[model samples]
Target: MGNFATLQPGGRPLVRFYLAFMLWFVGRAIQAAALVDPNVRKEFNDLPDDFSFSLGAAFNGPQMAIGKDSNGKVKYLGKNSNIVPQVKITIKSMEALFLLFTFRESTPVANSRERMTVEGNLSHACACVRILDIVQVYLLPKPIAKLAIKRYPKWSLKKHTINRLLINLRAIIGF
Candidate 1:
């Protein structure tokens, strides 16, 4: 006699929710960073007025979008909004997203590994990645940030400490 067994796994809701929350927090941090960090602001200034970008998991999973307005201020546009973004960076799977967010794989490593897909203009995407790296350096502590960012920035006191504190506070307060 032979026994038959089959197994199929369902989606991970908790992972999806966690990724969504992280994306939201990162979006807010980016918005706040644009205001508090000169480097972030400078990057935003180089982009077009209508520029926008999104980071998310593929196949309509969790996501967050950020955009720069005519005034050159950046804002978190929420998840999967009706407004189409100029750049979209998508992780191939939940596992990949998990690894990236968990700091097991940095953005550059993930990109090199083919774990992410980028759409739209390449130059704009590179700028957005640089902005994100700056934000990560501000948001995370030195030890952990070194793992997440490709190259740790050579930041001064105001940028590494004062600006980091301001960015966190403003991001929490949503201004």
Candidate 2:
């Protein structure tokens, strides 16, 4: 209902907990998406194998890093801020970020709502959004995904089934 950043009840412990949980949840989805999506791998292929990106709420909200391995498979880098991310998606508040994670808002929609901004290379931001879209395909059903993305792709049935199985398998097994 309101910005969690402004609330700060109990010194913001709830906000921190929510941010931490979302970071892990979204990080897993990103890893699964990157493992199976050709385009995601293609996007990272041009970058170094150790390349990483981040998404978080601005003003000290939770942030998580998504890094690529030598094979371009995405890995979760934990909540540590030791390694600087090459690109960062900064949502203006925890409320906005929660909306995005819940699929009530998409990246483009959030940007239009002035709830999020991207800092660093613009192309990387675009690439990261694409990666998020791939994650949505695996995580959300068609009707719900329609709400989360500007465009819900119309892939063939065979392709969808195969991709879904592979993505879900890796995501569940943590491989």
Best by lDDT: 1
| lDDT of each residue in 21-102, candidate 2, tens digit only | 8677668767876667776667778667777889898778888998887776678887776878888888998888878877
Q: What is the lDDT of residue 128 in candidate 1?
A: 94
For residues 1-175, what per-residue lDDT tens digits would candidate 1 score against the true structure?
2587776877998988888888888999999999888888999999999899999998778988999888887999999677899999889988899898888899999999999999999999999999989988988999999999888878788787789999899888889
The Cα RMSD in angstroms, rounded to one decimal, for candidate 1 relative to the true structure is 1.7
TM-score of each: 0.94, 0.83
| Candidate 2 residue runs with Cα over 4 Å from true position | 1-19, 69-71
lDDT for residue 119 in candidate 2, whole number 0-100: 78
Go through the candidates in order and give each one's C-alpha lDDT: 0.90, 0.78
